[model samples]
Target: MISTPPPDWNSYVQSGIHQPNLPTIQEINKAEFAPNVIRLGTGELSPHLFPRERMKQIFHRLANLIDSLGYEEPKGLLFLREQLSKYLKTIGIEASSSTILIVSGALQALQLISISLLQRGSTIFLEKPSYLYSLHVFQSAGMRLFGLPLDENGVQTKMITKQKKRQNASLLYTIPSFHNPTGILMSEERRRELIDVCEQERLI
Candidate 1:
């Protein structure tokens, strides 16, 4: 016969406050019975694809700058900012270095945008089956979210057109090119229509 554990010890062990869910990476590494774990769940690029030689040179250069190290400007490194600005211009986004607020990645960029723009109870529009991470960010910001369905072209612009007739939407979040999951691109006509709707609604 086996002895049962104490009630208080059981309660303590079951308490979720102290024992939360592990991060995806940690959980993946710790799993005892995973078979051929091709982890496409995380967005991390494969290590084999990285530019190892160039990264080594970049790290060496950054280490050399330690003597002049100070709190970087809130935006980020000026050289990187300028380089990003030039890159964006090449893609037709047309932005300046000063306008950029460099964050760690797209997740941080979405969080910053949500925090800066959303107010509690404000409504925002999103494409159906959108980025789960961005949805979480907006939810944490206390914004009301509504999903607009998508099709072969892109987000259902008809929904936006309809929404404009009634309540004001704070923002419209979309992945216009190579959309996540669906991998569909927004047509030029739809892009123009979206811009026009945003302009008409004065939402931007």
Candidate 2:
């Protein structure tokens, strides 16, 4: 009897509105959940680092104080938004509760923004070798990703000008504070420059 070759499973993943996560990203997701493995790249904290008692206290208060378990308003729970507004004030940011929109997490927030705000074929300028590369949310939504080089200071803002025009990029995404994977903190001066360039280019 003749031996048949193994099937190429990857050939089934056709490109379309939804794209599969990169092979490395899929591997990393599985590796993170493996027993005896410590996830260094993920945002999750170790069990010991979690504030268990404080969280329990908060949950206890919510169980007693929360009056309704019904679905929240479209934006989210008004009470939570109000609290978030107040917290923003303490950080020198003034935002009204009515303007606040809370989501489950950062991934959901990005997915919402990708579909709601961006048009199909829009380009997003982001730092090269970014954590965003690990996520297909934007790409799956019919947007393109353009990588901007990074230096010691942070993502090279100067490149945004020509590249923005060339790619017709609609917006930029960045993690300036303790940037994931790279761990490069953007300098204040570079931040200012980035703002200026974006403002000048009218690229939000």
Candidate 3:
């Protein structure tokens, strides 16, 4: 049998509307799957941390309980959303099940927000060294990301007002607790200030 050569992946990636993942991210994605490798600071949980037995039991239970494998509601399963609401309450977020939209994952949630909420040419304020920079979710949707400097507390709220007015920024994306890459947890005072700033500036 004759062999066929694979298409040029690099060309496809270059021509695509969505920007490619950062080189370091690409390396991390591939390296994490390699045998005997320990991935630290990556998005996914470690393999060793997975509850294999619990997952098996849950799957078995689900197999019996769930009669149909048909499509779920746009917001996802009701029970899951209810549970998430309860969980969020514990963390001081008073979200109702009706308000909650359960996405497949964080990336999907980001993509949904990027495309649905904001208009083209909208600006987003984010941490200077954010995980969002590695992904072009907002950028691909015709929005811009303006990075704010971070300190021990978290992203500098002081800069937000000026930047918001200057760039006409519409949204602020933050990982307050245990921020990605840097791992700088936002202080309670900082969180309050951020909320205040957002309210005053009318930034979401």
User: Which one is best on TM-score?
Assistant: 2
lDDT of 1 by residue, 1-204 (tens): 999965776566455322323487357555623655654444557678999999999998889666557778999998889999999988899899999887988878877777787776788888988875677677766677888999899998888979855667888889898787577899999999888888887775
Model 1: lDDT of residue 11? 67
Q: Residues 1-204, candidate 3, lDDT per residue (tens digit)? A: 988988999999877768778787788778977878875556578678899999999998889778668988898899889999999999999999999988877878888888888887888899989884434787778888889999999999989987888898989999998998798999999999999999999889
Q: TM per model? A: 0.70, 0.84, 0.78
Per-model C-alpha lDDT, please?
0.78, 0.86, 0.86
- Candidate 2's TM-score reads 0.84
Model 3 Cα shift for residue 2 (angstroms): 25
Evaluate candidate 1 by giving its C-alpha RMSD to the native, one decimal: 6.4
Question: What clash pairs does model 1 have?
Answer: none
Off by over 4 Å in 3: 1-16, 21-25, 56-63, 82-99, 132-134
Clashes of each: 0, 0, 0
